[model samples]
Target: MLPSASRMRRGEEFADAIRRGRRAGRPMLVAHLKTREADVPPLVGFVVSKAVGGAVVRNRVRRRLRHLMRTRLTAIPRGSLLVVRANPPAASARSEHLATELDVVLDRLLRGRRSESRTLTDGRS
Candidate 1:
């Protein structure tokens, strides 16, 4: 289970991350990431809509994602907001596959952020 302090609980928080964050999509899920300057712990939220399945299936997917994120919390930067929105395919995806895709997406997002910061600091237009 994700710690309460690290879980995103408000609508505005989710909206901000989804609207302003960098996003990456996979067959199973889409991830949004926004880095902030505050010194708080990273916050994570999940979106599992009816398109994914009924309550049971949606809850299962959410639980799996929470478990996956628990192990990956350290990899996310402090003060960052991450939202993982599940695709319909995620309803049937294996745990390992979800973990793999989550890792790949996160690495891609973090790498992109790093390069973007480098470009801004490199003094080149």
Candidate 2:
């Protein structure tokens, strides 16, 4: 399990990730913030709410999320906070399902963002 400090988004950060971040879907939201002058960026936190379930169930979801992130981190952009919200349907979601969903959304979001940045960098408006 990821440490709480490393696994949970606080109130303001969570709100920012929701409101300003580029959302991948209903199940996940992601926002990237550059580190304060560092080459290596750390994955900060992931939040799964009680609306997801009781303690045991919520923690299970979080663990699944962390594992997915670990496996797929290379595809994830640097300095990003990924907030994966659990739908009620996900309470019983299998590990493979959870991993696939996270991978799909993160890959799509990252690809779109990188392509847009490339276009802008190439002087396209």
Q: Candidate 2 at residue 88, lDDT?
A: 63
Residue 1, model 1, lDDT? 95
Q: lDDT for each of the candidates?
A: 0.94, 0.62
Q: State, as a TM-score between 0 and 1, how close model 1 is to the true structure.
A: 0.97
lDDT tens per residue, model 1, 37-61: 9889999999999999999999999
The C-alpha TM-scores of every prediction are: 0.97, 0.75
* lDDT of prediction 1: 0.94
Q: What count of clashes does model 2 give?
A: 0
Clashing pairs in 1: none
- Residue 36 CA error for candidate 2 (Å)? 9.1
lDDT of 1 at 122: 100
Clashing pairs in 2: none
Best by lDDT: 1
| Model 1 poorest ten-residue lDDT run | 116-125
Q: Pick the candidate with the highest TM-score.
A: 1
